[model samples]
Target: MQVFNVDKEKTLNAALLILNKLGQADYHKIFKILYFAEQQHLKNYGQPLTGDVYQAMPYGPVPSFLYDVFKASENQASPFSEALELSKAFTVSRKDKIPYVSPTREADIDQLAETNIEAIMASIEENYALTFKEITDKSHDSAWAKAEQATETEMSYLDIAESAEASPEILKYISLQAENHNLRIS
Candidate 1:
C-alpha cells in the first residue's frame, strides 16, 4: 500500500544499460524486457529492479518513467537530454510504427546490481526475437489482467507480488507494518 519513490537517474541509467547490452531494439521490446526483469526481481527480492511505476497500456505493461525519459530524450530535454547525449543513446525513426533505440556509449552500469543486470540480460535473450504483439501477449499475465480489471493505469507492486506468488510472508508482514506506520519505501 506504500508508494515507492523511483530514482530517475538510476532508472535512466539502467534503461541505457539494458539497451547497451541488448544493442538496438524497438521501444515495445525494450519495455517488455524491462517489465519481465522487474517481475523477476520482484519475485526474488520482494522489490522491483528499477522501482519504476508500471502502467497497463493498450500495447502492454510499460515502465512509465522510462517511457517518459525516452520521449524526453527524443525532444532533447533537460536531464534526459543530457543523459542520452552523454550515453550516446538515441531513438531513431520516431515516425515509424516502432521506434528503435541505438545505444552508442557505455551505460552507467554501477547504478544497478549485478543480479538486476543478469535478469535483464536473461529476459532479452529469452524474448528478443519475439514480435511486439508476442511480447504484449506474454505480458498479459495475472498481474496485468488484475490491474486492467480495476481500470488502473498504474499497476500496483502489491498486485504484482500477489501474482508472482513468491513474496515471503516476512516481507509481506513488514510491508503491512510499514503501511500501518505511514512509511513509504524509497
Candidate 2:
C-alpha cells in the first residue's frame, strides 16, 4: 500500500484497464479482492475503514482512484469507453505510466492489468517486509506495551505495515489512513 500521489490520468488509465479486463459484468471480483484486502488490514490495525481503502489493502486491482478519474470525465463512458478514449488521448510513454501495456481490447487490457496488479502486490509484499522490520526494530523492547507505544509514536510505519497486508478492495482505505497518519506526523 505505497500511497503515492499519482497523476489523475495515470490512475484513470489503470482503472480503465482493470474494468475493461474484468469486464463490466464480472468486474466485481477485482473490486472484491481489493476491498477485502483493505478490510483485512483494518482488522489487523484495529482501525475502521472510513476512507481511502487503496492504501490499506493488499493484492491489486483496487479501482477507487481509477473510478474517480473515470467518473470525472465529461463523458461518463463505461470502462470500455474511457479506455478507448485513453488509448487515443495518451501516448505510448503515458501508457507506460499505467500498468496496462496496451489498450486494444478488453482481454488484452485485462491481462495487462492483472499482470500489473501482481507486480503491485509483489512490490507491496517486499516493502511490507522492510516496513515490518523497521516497525519491529523501533518497537524492539521485548514488551507488548513498548511495541504498541513505539508504533503509536510513529504510526505511519505501523499503518502502512497493516495496509501492506490488507486485501485489495480495502487497500484504498488503508492508504487513506496511512496518508492521514503521515500528515499528522509531518
Candidate 3:
C-alpha cells in the first residue's frame, strides 16, 4: 500500500485556502471539494499538494489528519481541542446547529504552488455549489471503495491516481515516488 505521509502544515493551509474563499462552509463541502482538488493535483502534477492521507469516510474520502484537526477544533469542550496547533489558525463553529469552518487568519498562500491554487480554485468553482448528496456521490469512486471495503480505511495513492484517470506513465511515476518516499512525504 502506498501512503503519503501527512504534511500537517500544508494540509491546514490548503484547507484554510478553501475556507478563506468560502468565508465559512460546512465540513461536507470543504472535504468534498478538497477530494476533487486532490484528484486534480494528482492528475496534473503527479504529486500531492496538501499531502493529507485520505480515509474512506461515510461522507467521502476525508483527509485523516485534517478531519482530526477539524473535529478537535469544533469540539472545543474536549481536551484534545487545546492540544491541536491547527486550532490557532482555523475555527469551527456552529450555526443553525450545523458545523461550519472559518479561518482565523488568511491562508498562507506561499505554501501552495500556482498550479495548486489553480486546481483548488477550479475545484471550488466546480464543487462548492453542489448539494451534499451530489458532492458525496461524486467522491464515491473506485479508490474510496477500495478503502471503504478494506480492514484499514486508508486510501492508497495508487488507487487515487487510478481513480483520477491518470495515465499509465503518470501512475508509474506516482508509484515510484511513493515507493521512494517510503511513507515519509515532504
Candidate 4:
C-alpha cells in the first residue's frame, strides 16, 4: 500500500482542536484519542483522519509525526515553534513527573473536514475520561499487537487495513498498485 503523506499543519490543528475539547490532557491521553480517531477513519473510509503513521509505543499506538510535534512543542523547537506556537496554544506543567497539556488558544478547525472533526469529537467523548493506563490498555488491539511484534517501530497501513477488515479485493488492488508504483508498504 502507498503510505499516505500527512499534512502536518492540518493534523496539528486537528490535535489542538481535540485538546481544546478535552480542556486538558497528558501526552498519553492525547495520543490515545488521536489513535482511536485514526483507527475509526481508517476502518470506515480506508483512510486515516490525519494520514499520520502510527507506531506501537509501550503505552499504546501513537501518531508518530504528531508525537514528534508534541515533543518539539515541549522543547520549543523549530517548525512546531512557528506553526504550533506552543507558548500561545498550550500550557505545560509537570505533575509528579508526567506533563499535563492544556490548550490556551482555539484550534484552527477550518483546516479539518467536519466529518473528521466529528469523528475525533466522538472519540474524545468515548475515551476522554479514562485514566492513561485504562486508555493504553484499551489500545492493545490487533493492529498495535501486530506492530509490537514487528522489528521496525513503524506500523504498516496495510496491516491496519487488514485489521480493520478491509475487503480482500481492496487489499489486492492496493497490493497491485503498490507493486506497479514501486511504493513501499511500510
**RMSDs, each prediction?**
3.4, 14.5, 2.7, 2.9
Report the number of the highest-lDDT candidate.
3
lDDT for every model? 0.72, 0.37, 0.82, 0.75
lDDT of 4 by residue, 1-186 (tens): 246777776677778888888888888898888878777666666566887878888888888677776666666765644445534466667799887887768888888888789879989998998986789898887778887988876777667667667788656765665566676555
Better of 2 and 4 by TM-score: 4
Model 3: C-alpha RMSD to truth? 2.7
When 3 and 4 are scored with TM-score, the better candidate is 3
Report the CA-based lDDT of candidate 2 relative to the real structure.
0.37
lDDT (0-100) at residue 68 of candidate 4? 70
Residue-by-residue lDDT tens digits, candidate 1, 9-67: 66766677777877787778888888888777777777678778888887888887777
| Candidate 3 local lDDT, 55-172, one digit each (tens) | 8988899887788788878765335543276776778888898888888999898888898889899999999999989999999999999889989888877788789999998888
Per-model TM-score versus the true fold: 0.82, 0.31, 0.90, 0.83
lDDT of residue 158 for candidate 4: 65
Give the CA lDDT, 0 to 100, for residue 40 in model 4: 68
Instruction: Please name the candidate that would achieve the greatest TM-score relative to the true structure.
Output: 3
Give the TM-score (vs. native) of candidate 3.
0.90
- Candidate 2 on 17-91: residue-level lDDT in tens? 444443331222333333333334344443422233232122222345443433333233545554445444222
Residues forming the 10-long window of minimal summed lDDT in candidate 4:
79-88
For model 3, the local distance difference test gives: 0.82
Residue pairs clashing in model 4 are none
lDDT of 1: 0.72
Question: Which lDDT value does model 4 have at 69?
Answer: 65
Could you tally the backbone clashes for each prediction?
Answer: 0, 29, 0, 0
